[model samples]
Target: MKKTLIVVCTLFTFGATAGTEDSGNELSYEHFVHSDKPIKCLYGYAAEKVGDHDAAIAIFEDCIARWESVYAMIWLAQIYDTGIGVPQNLEKAAALLKRGAHTQDEAGYSSLAKYHYGILLLEGRGVPVNKQAGIEWLQRAADEGVDEAKDYLQSMP
Candidate 1:
């Protein structure tokens, strides 16, 4: 009976230690998708959800700069532009959108192209007001199957 108890305790201790180590080694989005820093974008999102805009902005920016992932860049741009978790910076947003548009990520391309093109047309940001061009890009986004693009196209004047 003593031997059986010892064996059970050893197994329990080993399992607990192994589980703790595994949790410690678990990869966050920062480790898995972003850079070595703890700049997990989902962490940023969670922070934003809890109204920790400053923390969220910091994490989002870190994720964007560390990974340069299209999605990360987009989120960073959004946060900056809308003042979600950062100060509104239209220039930065446009720059990020341009970066996304120039990249090969189809989803990124569709999103950035349509939004930047449309906003530029409506607000005359960096480009000339070219409503037709905006429409064409939006159509391309819709054809590429961006959900917002389809809705935007359907709502177009």
Candidate 2:
């Protein structure tokens, strides 16, 4: 655990410093990783938005391992699914989405996760096509206020 923390901290420190003026700031990445609140987990999104996928992947991987963060899982899943900064791996993407779906925290986040997982199932991206299961997941997402899921369900045949 200590080794992992050190590695994660190093990654975060470099990522945090990149494109920032804080060249010599003594920022403690461990504090964010160990914090009870997960405010810093969203940094991966900024990395993703700026096309720094390597940093995003590292940050999101940290978030999932440390906090099981829903958004991080979803973002990483997309990166894998789309081959963004890495080779496409549908199975990996689906697996991450599966974990996100089973996550008990963050209900709204789970809804979005379920919606994405349902699409993968419906399209057989990495798993066998199970329309019934896909529809069920989509329905759950719709019930939880996922607008895209509602639209998908409404447009279903």
lDDT of each: 0.56, 0.75
Task: Name the regions of candidate 1 deviating beyond 4 angstroms.
Answer: 1-39, 106-117, 125-128
TM-score (C-alpha, index-matched) for candidate 2: 0.76
Give per-residue lDDT, candidate 2, residue 94. 97
lDDT at position 107, candidate 2? 32
* Candidate 2 segments whose C-alpha is farther than 4 A from its true place: 1-37
Clashes (backbone N, CA, C under 3 Å), per candidate, total: 0, 0
What tens digits encode model 1's per-residue C-alpha lDDT throughout 12-88? 45432221222332433222232344324445554455576765666667766666656556656666678765677
Distance from true location, Cα of 93 in model 2, Å: 0.5
Query: Which structure among the candidates has the greatest lDDT?
Result: 2
Best model number under TM-score: 2
As for model 1, its CA RMSD to the true structure in angstroms is: 12.8
Positional deviation of residue 64's Cα in model 1 after best superposition, in angstroms: 2.1
